[model samples]
Target chain A: MLDGLIVSIDAMGGDDAPEIVIEGIEYFLKHEGKGRRARFLLHGDQPRLDKLLKKNPLTRERSEVCHSPTEIAMDEKPSQALRKGKGTSMWNAILAVKEGRANTVLSAGNTGALMAMSMLQLRRMHGIQRPALAANWPRPEGISVVLDVGANVEATASQLAEFAVLGDAFYRALFKKEHPSIGLLNVGTEDQKGHAVIKAAHERLAESDIGLNYKGYVEGNDISFGNTDVVVTDGFTGNVALKTAEGTAKLIGKFFNEALQGNPWSKFTTMLNSVALIKLKKRIDPRGVNGGVFLGLNGIVIKSHGGTDKVGYSNALNVAIGLAGSNFLEEIEREVERLHDEDDNIGFIE
Target chain B: MLDGLIVSIDAMGGDDAPEIVIEGIEYFLKHEGKGRRARFLLHGDQPRLDKLLKKNPLTRERSEVCHSPTEIAMDEKPSQALRKGKGTSMWNAILAVKEGRANTVLSAGNTGALMAMSMLQLRRMHGIQRPALAANWPRPEGISVVLDVGANVEATASQLAEFAVLGDAFYRALFKKEHPSIGLLNVGTEDQKGHAVIKAAHERLAESDIGLNYKGYVEGNDISFGNTDVVVTDGFTGNVALKTAEGTAKLIGKFFNEALQGNPWSKFTTMLNSVALIKLKKRIDPRGVNGGVFLGLNGIVIKSHGGTDKVGYSNALNVAIGLAGSNFLEEIEREVERLHDEDDNIGFIE
Candidate 1:
């Protein structure tokens, strides 16, 4: 157990690829201090990786390199690659998790492909109709886990309620927060509002004996304010909201850069403001919270951004390790079993 | 034509109703400087207003006070209010726009009630299937307009395309940006992705002779960035994304306030950083944006936040004045007619 857990990294998945991901891992290993308990399985071309390691040499007793000859194209359809390209890095990483060669899997590849592969290969826990992609985002009030960010856009009310339960379990295990509040994302907070499906799910959630800190309904704005700890929504809305936030931040950065470039005085001000800007960027960038754990799956699968750098990929790897090290998967099952025992359909909608 | 541009204010709407709304109007009247024009009709309890105005003075003579004996509670059911609460502040405000008593209406009241009343009274535009609530939110890059924000949760491809047109027109009129770039909000930037309706709309938009800067596809994160001038999505997703952005800003503000609450040293640092924070806040705050315009209505109908202060309500009134002043309805009609004349069905899927 002290050996911790090993996470396999698909070093070729993201935009920056192996270089930045490898550099980031090196940074962590060198700076993370002693007593950091975790091992790593970095998968990529051995020759390409050796060159990187030779230049930035570090002790790698706890890390191993796994070579994969095939690389997945970013633009290729996830389904096609999953079926036809078994030798690709993505397929190998999934295989690693299934074989128990790696405790968890982390990748910044095509999200759709990752979700599809996990669902088809790893399968879902008993009673789970659909697994969810839960994004743990830091809000001003607290952190919120927004589930189904893009896993399944259209879902039954029962699926939404199940997502809520899974999200609750995930948040509780990860954050160790007592009674994390669960909110149903809707157009309004009114009891009479929302679509037909949400209405049914709301009723089911209200009646559940799963000991959830149910907070009724919340809107998109509620997520950032930490008004609710676990925000449950259909994948369509959650995905849109998450992406819009990211786009807005990027736009803001661009505008500020242009403004600062207008004059020397502005440049000085920008320099003075760099510390605060960096802090704010760190606070808002989704990359900082790089990995979104695929909840309700048989084993842990953390999905990182496809545009991740070494820092981002390593962050994803670390998140996977942390989840595995903490026995997060076991605890989630326990919570679900407890909820199921209480009602057997605590998250089911009639 | 000048008389066809009067704005009636529901002084009873919003958190700090009447007083702040009144004060905001007074500020505009005093500071409007030159060439600014519009008449104001204040609809609320006249007795209380008379008492309040005794302490605050007005600069303009284009003011009329209409008595609304009853007030709709902020949290009251909008459906009930629309059907039953005749002669209430909200109802009178709607009547002002519908009956041509005023060219535009501005109310910081129950959003649901306002939306219900507008749809029922003003009716949808000719050949339009749905009316969308569009708001121009200030982002760090520039102003981005997001539409169908909770007016209707689900919308068809044609409806969304119509919203794109409406948003484009509004952005052009208000910001003076010629031929603004319009984006269909989706989870992925790829053409084949997104729900069936959106994919259909995307195709339609691409082929149409709509004289729009048709930027292929945008994800949610694209909203805050100047990447797209107008972002269109179904009401359910749009509303959630807008609110989530607002909530996040608020939470961030709260965090900063709490972090810098005490100690002279920290206070000094905060004061030093206050300018940046204020600038950022002004750019992100929905209240700063003030009103969400109900497009495709017969007349301008501005929906203000129920929790807004008097200043916010006044800003809502001002937004209405600007919308009317700009002859936004006429422009939209012209644009719609142009699109209709093209006889092009804008969509990818049938």
Candidate 2:
């Protein structure tokens, strides 16, 4: 009886496999997915999925189980996963999308393995030389989209330009903004700062009239400050910046905990401020923004945090539904042609 | 009646130069520098420094004004600063060290300009190809030293090794740790992770017996977790990582402030937790760790934050005093000889 946008899921993915996946679907249905006509294709062990589904009637009623013989291990190498990844839950989930059986595919599995398998099965879009993995960053005000977080180790001048177009289009489609401002991640905001590749990209974007509202270069700190809607960078720097921010947030959380358990007076005061403190805690909770969308692909594939619980997984599922329902795929397709034109006209004077 | 551990001060460098520079010396002498035999040679506009010195009795008693005719502008390019930098406060401060008139030099000026002037005046050590900028990072527990933060854009395999040696020595000298553990900053901690330069450095550091307490690779979060005593990376990545962390901390502080302006109950409770909250603020305050030591040079030069106030400048003065007193200079010199051997023996198989 499920009759809307279908989402294929690798149920055997993540640290707490199958359990969180089933519970996540249940959480999504009762909460954010309440009235939406969204269904899921659960790909995992038949017996395990059956028992878990029985405990959650809503998910069991809406979803159809697609039996997968084997499961991919969390620590398996990408090459090994690619060599023998077929018929596995992760593989079958993507296969559903390839066969047009599902609107999108999602996995909380090994990132390298998933990227490799997704590339092999779904194939790249029209003119993307390298597909980017766009991750959401929680800013002081709202969320900002950062791309090429860890898709490729290095990015060329032309490829950085490609990311700007992809990121700009993706931001506009999801946020429904007429024009989303984009900025390149760099050491400094000045024109002459950072490496050769970044400088070249800045020059190209500043000159080209590709309809992107380019905001020039933004520093690492600017990502958290929400200076731009979308931030672009090479995979190496982006990955490091993302991890560093995560670590800083965790460290402060630990300090906050330790501060509360000090003197009796301090401990008593913390209880008095519990309501405001709770709001502060909820705002910074990592579970709120819990998905990385694999962009420039043939089909929509969301990669949730491997260690996230049911609540976190629900947020990622919400992201999947949000993107799948929008006209993002078509919008990106149009941008790709314009991007190709920009790619051919690079005249680096520096 | 000025005594031991003489530090040359660039009185006309920072945003609020001459004023904070004189007050910072006074603050240091009263607080951390109290009862210690520390003296300063203030380099800047004579009449301004002389007028400011009259306001501070302690600094007036111990410091001597070495009047420089001009000052380096905060945003001056390195090349431009170098071409016309003679007799300027920043230039003369480094010159004082070159002439052996002071034990160390401290500047709160243009970072690029300072680096360029320092390199030219003091020159590199016996085997140092590039001198690194060692910055202090506030951790949950104590502190960590991250190096090559914007000293150079990119680092080769051997240069990274040199950084490790310099960082290890720097950490030991500052913290008084017998064997400080050093970690190479990378996207992942795995042995097979990161770019070719990183992989080569990791292999060399892992196999070499260069008398360093090497802890292999560490991710970005590890820097805040106090997982290692020292974290080393190329200048560009290090600069980005440092700025990103600063921004995250600032964002969290903003959230806490907004959380308190909710309702009357929240406002009443905030006063109760004021003691503990103040303690938490102090724990993450940027002013506490204020200096970036220029490593691999013949002399010691501490770069105070350009925008920092008197309190922050005072902390930078403390760092200058700490290293100037210790044999950090000699320790780095000893390690440089061993690092040269590691550089020549780079047999990168992969």
Candidate 3:
């Protein structure tokens, strides 16, 4: 039997607060087969959590409620939150991981504050300058991982190369793929295209013996087409592409709905085919993949969408538990150390 | 009566060359109300052009065939095309504009070759360092213009600010909206969120008295939400976002199609609502907005997608004719000069 993994949860964060968080825990316990191999550390107002947890005896039996009087607001500035967030639920959850009481932390909170607190408490890994947020994007074949979504706006050539290694480790850990094909996102596929940083990063990644199956450059359309297993880019461009894809999907869905409701015949036809449409909708739903993992930190931290419901929040918790159960952190640390050793060997040879 | 505007067309370019190009011109002359106010300078092999023109009497009546024995291949490198591009049809069309024989040029040729030839022949406008390709993206309310889609991959703060002015003028010429609201595309809406270049550009745009209704920073989702009339960014980021949006739309469309063909019932539903669905498809068709206007050049040049059909080709021609009829080039030149004059005045005052 595997050792029981403990996931720290910031129950006071997100738009729905402790209610949705508790409900999500119940949903995960009910549906997830791996739920029996995990324990939970719920950080929030003890009184409210205790009341909510009473309805779900199984979750209450496997979870502990820790008191936290403060919570970060959704729109609070990162600096202000850092100054005043010592005892907040998000801070406490991260602290549990930092103190070795939990394997990982999961929060549906303000992304900037969560990233800020995680960086401060856990610190970056030995060879990493900045941590990146890796998002699991839905594609036709399966899902592809895209990194630096909004963690850092700009990335240097070295930082981009680091992102490739981080993304490679992430895909291996989550998908259990031995080697995932990685691509650097660019405007064009040619090596000569894009800016100097991208070209330099491409050269660095191509030349390095970092054990990554580095495919050359890929364009924006390749993200949805699943042309590569991992798509890496600077945070500003990645964030824009991610949000634009989301917005476009939403717009098309709206158009689809409007088209189905145009006439009586169309309405009847829609009713007849509602099941198929619902299946397609479920296949492409963003709620199933709601977490953005903060890579390159000493411990794992997952950020869930603030407005997600119990279903979405449960999915995020599942991702946290999955990462916690694996040796993801150790794998990344070992890879980074190995790459540094290789660099040292190259230096001596030169 | 309006003077007959001449639009130079490269009949040898695009996937469906002389046939589709000639058919598109016929289609435009058949239905377009402003067809009587414009004439076409058809540049290609004289024999092929004459044969295609014989089939469409109206197009032949309104168009004059120009002999161009050489043609640039779609896969030809920009440098190679630039070296030996004198007698090519794409070259002749642009040369007509440079020599003031045509008000504008339209080509569905290779983008790299078109950009290179336009830069070498027509040249850049005074005070403009690089030209930008501005694309009209469809939004729910109407349309928004996004610039530097794939022109120069990297941009300085001043270049980004200049794009805002170029985009503003393009929007005004096309949509007839004075003082179109412009926003800088960034990872977040907050002032301090993006990279140093974006921050500096934000300051430049916000503080300048350049007669622009600057709306500050906008996120990627804002492009489809129609939050701003113009969205400006570095070419690499803009190109990625644009292609990502296109890819997302395509993926959703595929899902929609698959759902509608799942069973006999869905097939029936699709049959019943075919008209409404077709209307929706037409509303969002990329072919209707096929042209990407190359801004900041001394003369106007429109690039059509190389694989587009007659419908798409006609739309590109319409865009060229529309801009040619308006004082689009003069508007850009005057606005750029005004901004430069203001900079000089500020320097003297300091």
Candidate 4:
């Protein structure tokens, strides 16, 4: 019954709504979406989307619009979003996946609203107490995934264990790695380092026979080291760390510009090295890593940065298409069941 | 009677000890410590200290070596250090402050051991639950201070409130800013964004008017914005954020280096911009900003990086001399008492 990989999109969500969304799809179909059977179910005001789609021929050829009368505010509270936000573009975007009309959902909307609506409609996968937002973190060489970036403020030991299983499957499904290493983010690498919750989660990960590449504990530096494929932590710590890294990257970029443009001679020399500088700029470009995949949900949901441009949104769409085309959801279901089975066996053995 | 600001130094603590310590003192005496009545009591093997001190004319003239037979290892456990670490150079360094022989203590030793011995010797000030380690965080313009970087794993609401007071006095003394704005670090700026602990701290700081500048909440990005002078969080989150920023800075530096060396033209251009690059290097140099100060203790104890060079150690020595001369302790005591009085009045009003 499924006709190719369908991506449900909230076209009216981000700062520059239907414009960026339509142009982003067009950009992706030309760049990253070539030769792929990626179809989009755009959810937004039909009048505005039609106008934008007329301007974007590639997106017009590959997508169908679903009329949505309302759009959630960017700064709306989650509870308020769920109360009066049904039938809205953001809500219907997730509803399409819940109704099995779409393979995955992608939204550049309010993260809290997207998370809230996803939980209300699709619900958590079997044995998943909490759904988490796993982000694509740029490492020293390649990319790694860090989970619970900002979905839940806190997580129990078992939930952290489930995150590992989910994140492991995520990395494996995306990169096709067989045994990607997992590291629990802690204050120190020692067994007796962080809070009681962290220690408990560490113990469960260490003792469980979940068959994961469970490396012991890791410090904050390990997140950027690239040796570890998956980094796990509660949402509070993960959110702060993510933003801190982002702020640091921006500050360094500013410092780099200042370094190159101090004087006329310096500026001229910097212009001469523009080719290499452009190459470096592409490598550390934030657009390359823009999507945050919502794991542990029954259906796939990817949240893009709310204030991103067309290029960043297109990168997120590239991720959504790649994940939609794969067996990512099925892989997670199998891993989650195996993790719970290990827990049950441990409970009985004890 | 105390003649001048006598600084007790753990000369045998760091990776390259006695050498860096002696050289660092000489460097500080010539630079930041010029015309300051700062005397040093170096604690280590006397023969080694004597040899190193003799090689450095200024340090030899200003410092007296205190004989200590043992030195704590770089990676020793706090409990083990507490039990068997007595009479060691680190322990004796704190002892000099406890006995009023020195105004402050400085060490480039194991952080856990330094914290443990300082607590055993100086103990916490009145109305203070746990001591906190405050580090200087470089902002976009000026510098800000973040507390509980690695002192305690968790902090209660009242402890977080107390950190505002301690960090406030710390900022004022170090920067001569009379009333610096304080911000509590959280996942988001919303009241309902983070864990209950964070919410409670927010409420406590919001309601209580201890006549301090307490801005409600800030995210990780705010730390580098330089708008807020003091950022407060638990040790777990603070430690992770600090290290995460450091790692990001280093990674960016690596990327910049790789960017400039891609081809012959880039190499020549980069060589031409060497003067500007050197200016950039000095502006963001980690050596200029070194040292972690232990607040809420009866005496001042500064922790320098264990693997830092003489330049880094000298910056830390500069902090030690500055704090030793101020009434930083008295300011915290007065603010803490006023905070408790406000709590009592609130209880009565209710």
Candidate 5:
């Protein structure tokens, strides 16, 4: 029996639906042996989940399948879904966290709907001017946390500063880094490089003693390197940049495969250089690190790709466990309080 | 003796300087063979270039070296350097294109400096609103051209429409497509998804006809795929997204190598998957497609990376020749006129 933590998995959330999600959850449970025990609650149509359970026995001892009648489509407007689809797998998963039935929630479908449901259900942490969604981008110096990927399109200087604090907390909790470096994404690294919003935020970050090893301004190209552990930006630019990177990686992979596949000579070359190819694939695979946790929310919430596979879904569950096991909430609260005290001293934003 | 197009390469440009640039020019000449006779005039410190040339026996057969007294620092402000460093390799290379000594100009140096020099020397095309920097991103179907990567940060609706025209012309000419589909990059694909600039530009694009197949709006995630032939945006978002993708690819490459090189078992696995690794590497390697061609200028002006290697420099030279080989200037002029005529008749942009 799992007595360590509780995590709710949206079994019918992703594009491939119950089959992939169920298999992924099973894989995660099997891999995560007896040492780290977490109670798994599957939220979806009970009948469907039961059918899958019959096919594959989940390794976890303590688990339950909760029935959620409805579902939000990938194309549905987030706000509308939150208002109407209250019984959806996504909504139920969020509701579990709200009711203390689950300490964390994981969903691999409809990111917008998940975010909306999370905000509406869990509510934001007190003094969080705006809730931000943080994603982990694998950098040369390990992984960096980038917040405001798509939570709020427009933000004030104070909100950007808040994101930095939250991101620093996240990096510390997950990576166990001390005084993680924080950077503000701008057109250039110069102090006077970006627009008015960024300039104001830069000043705020500089002045604030938020316990961050503030790295000052960082350009778009520096985000991928080990240059900074946390990058803060407005949702518009961050969201676009993240999606663009993902799309570009996929495109490059497709092109590379097509250009070097299906020929005798090509196959021979491929055999000769198989080591490099495997290494490269592992490096760019989004599934290698799935479920970007929605930081700054009351509880741990993970946003996975809508088109995720079985392995991807499984990875999302593991990410939720990581967030919970690392004591993310406690760390964030402490950091938020530290920032709050500093803000109060310097006349904090109301 | 060169019979075809001629391109002036800034030999002193980029981080590696005259050595790598000279080698790149030699590689280009050697690969071009006898039939494709294109002259590459290396512009830099004749003495330094001569010393670098001694490493390789490259006679002035299909290539020549021109003396440029000064060199532009990558970190120097563009406006200040443009006024002071008149005899720099970057400035002289642009001047060569303007003076009809070279049909195209390519540089692996400061992008801002190149843009300033190109704008001052060749001048913007008549009827063209503002010059836009275009980069070709590989996709599943083929490659798509993205415009205004970093030319004008705050662009007007008129400028974006003009970019649409230039991008359409370039896409058609290079891809040899009868009707190239063009998309305006925005937060969402809906008509009213973005701010004032995008809203205004969306209306303008729908009305303007430079023989473009208007594909409405495209989101960031769709950029790497051939959802549209040409993706148009203001420099601010475009530049951030492009650099982010490039940086992400570089980081991914670095991270994988580090992770795989840790142990003997992983190294053996990596070796076995070498074909996949090379295929993946080829996908993300910026050297394969190094430069962003400055469109809407009177002549072909290519902006290579400031930290370009020999292969990257060679690719930039190849891109310049490709631009010069095609009737870019004439087509750009014709497209502007066509767009203007259509806009006038339909009353698109006021």
Candidate 6:
């Protein structure tokens, strides 16, 4: 289904560098049969990537290496990286998407640097004031898309409305849904709740004809309860909420593990139920969903965690490939145009 | 230690009503020895409360029922509840604190109504612009005090500083820590991160000498990781983060249960490990830390979850008694005065 799709990879970005990045590519191609139809444009140190690719025959057969001498340091500031990051691997991968050499860009680099480079290179979409970073939040029902995780610190009322439209289109493209339920993440579900920006956004979203299934307001608990398909908010609060959830999950896991290993009875029981425990761990593992998609940009950019291993890096590749195959950028463009036209009509009516 | 401390209870506030309220009192006094040192002022339907208290001799001996014919509905709006809330159990409980009949008030009712009544009856402290809701978040190391959970939707920089002082005093009073490490919650640990209000607050906190051990910025994950003794933020973000953590915990618990019940082998192992699992659950139970302390007010008020049962309500009662015995309101007043004097000095320096 993804035949001829090319994904640009920053092989020098993550902790393990070319080794894990190349292994991740091999794992994805070997485990996911549809992945065989995809091609790769790997950017990194030429000699290092060449040696790693030589070890993985399958990946070597389906990939082409682009020699990039420079690499962005994991702790480099975004402004500093942008100023001196012309030929770096992370920059090259993003540039490939802008040059039409690849459909999407995937990097496990410093988030700040990646965001800054992508914004400067790919630029924002026609009607977007700022780009949003979105993540797939796992819930009991399925998955919900939460946006503005950390791309921008603050968002205005119009910008929040824009995020709603952006998230709606992104979900529709990925899930093939005609209409996905959308919600503005707030402190409370009531109309009178939240601050002035959120209240104004709620009023605008409710009145606007953006073809969105806007479900007024949703609280923090509602995000994981699967109350809506897309939860949109300003980046600061969304980032805090996302990290808090991740931390809480980790804390609970730590508690569970300690409890199981504390005594002889628990140890024996854990050994007996190792299969079930493994299944549960795999189901909730953060590595399985380790990608933050950059929205409201002209090109697709998926950010993998900087410290993630092969399994996590592969998941990021899968996310990028799936989004590229779906032509997500085209969907966003159409949605943005439709919303603009609707707004103009509403102005005339008023 | 409670001695002659009196805690006013809203007997008709929660979903289970006077029965659970009276039962919770009994459970606390029975399980926690320190609970018996305190007295109770029950506000509710006099005949119903009288009949329930009659069944528990210990509770009957220490409690005095105040006839309150009306009760605040769980879904009543704040404005509506305030206009016609006179003589209602929730209102009477707060009034008892204002009238100096009780050291503190505990309510398991509509959060909006309770907040409105508390603000109307108790009023904000002399130098405090807004009151904050603080909760004891249990972590692996210990409990961290997180404030501004849902009292004010938006907080100014000055108000955030006020919350820091309030939370500092609160932690000191309850935990007897003369100087608790405090952190301002934000998207990142970097000083330059977050919005204008947060940035301003961070600068003010760093410069001002209100006897606070300000630990700079902390991210969402820090709250459960026990990075600081107190984590402060605007109520909107704080509420979202709190609920998100709760929702994530519930989701993980559900996943664990489903995985255990999937097969006979797993079920057998789960049965064998039931003791360890129960112990873990008890240790992390949300009910054990059920109350949200209303800080920055002239008097102390605690809000319990409306849907909680006897165990949860008992935990809330314990929290109320703890604060009452510690003289939390007076501590807050003292802290506010010190912060004001320090602010005046800083203004002169600038």
lDDT of 1 at A167: 89
Off by over 4 Å in 6: A1-3, A33-35, A348-350, B1-3, B348-350
| Candidate 3 runs further than 4 Å off | A1-3, A33-35, A345-350, B1-3, B33-36, B347-350
Error of 6 at B199 (Å): 0.9
How close is every model to the real structure, measured as TM-score? 0.90, 0.97, 0.96, 0.97, 0.88, 0.97
**lDDT of prediction 1:** 0.75
How is the predicted docking of candidate 1 categorized under the CAPRI scheme? acceptable
Candidate 1 residues A1-350, lDDT tens each? Answer: 23666777776676677777677677666654245766667777878877777766652556677888977766777777677556667777877888898888877777777777777778998777789898978776457899889887677887887788888878877777878899999988888878888898888778877688888999877778656889999888888878766655565555445644555654555565555556655666666678888999888888887777655666666667667766667766776776556555443425
Residue B3 lDDT, candidate 5, scale 0-100: 76
Q: Kindly indicate the candidate among 3 and 5 with the higher DockQ.
A: 3
> Model 2, DockQ value?
0.80
| Two-way DockQ contest, 2 vs 5, winner | 2
Task: Write model 2 residue lDDT over A264-348, tens digit each, in one string.
Answer: 9988878888898899998888899898988888999999999999999999999998899888888888887786776566543
Q: Which candidate ranks first by DockQ, i.e. highest? A: 6
TM-score for the B chain of model 1: 0.90
Tell me the tens digit of each residue's lDDT in model 2 across B1-350.
Answer: 55698999999999999899888989988899899898889999999998998899999888899989998999998888998889899999999999999999999999999999999999998888789998898777788999888898889887898899899888887889988889999877777679999988888888878788898999888888856888999998898888889888988989888887688898888877788888888787899999999999999999999999989999999999899999988888888887776556754332
True contacts kept of each: 0.58, 0.77, 0.72, 0.65, 0.48, 0.81
Local error of candidate 1 at A254, Å?
A: 5.7
Using TM-score as the measure, name the better of candidate 2 and candidate 3. Answer: 2
Per-residue lDDT for B1-350 in model 3, tens only? 23699999999988888788888888888776344678889999999999998999878888899999999998888898998799999999999999999999999888989999999999999978789999988877788899989989989887887898899889999889988999999988887789888888888788789698999998888888756999999899999998998888877777778877888877886787787788779877888778999999989999998888888888888888888889978888888888778767665221
Residue pairs clashing, model 2: none
Worst 10 residues of 5 chain A by lDDT: A54-63
RMSD (CA, Å), each prediction? 3.5, 1.7, 2.4, 1.9, 3.7, 2.1
Error of 4 at A17 (Å): 1.5
Residue A118's lDDT in candidate 2: 92
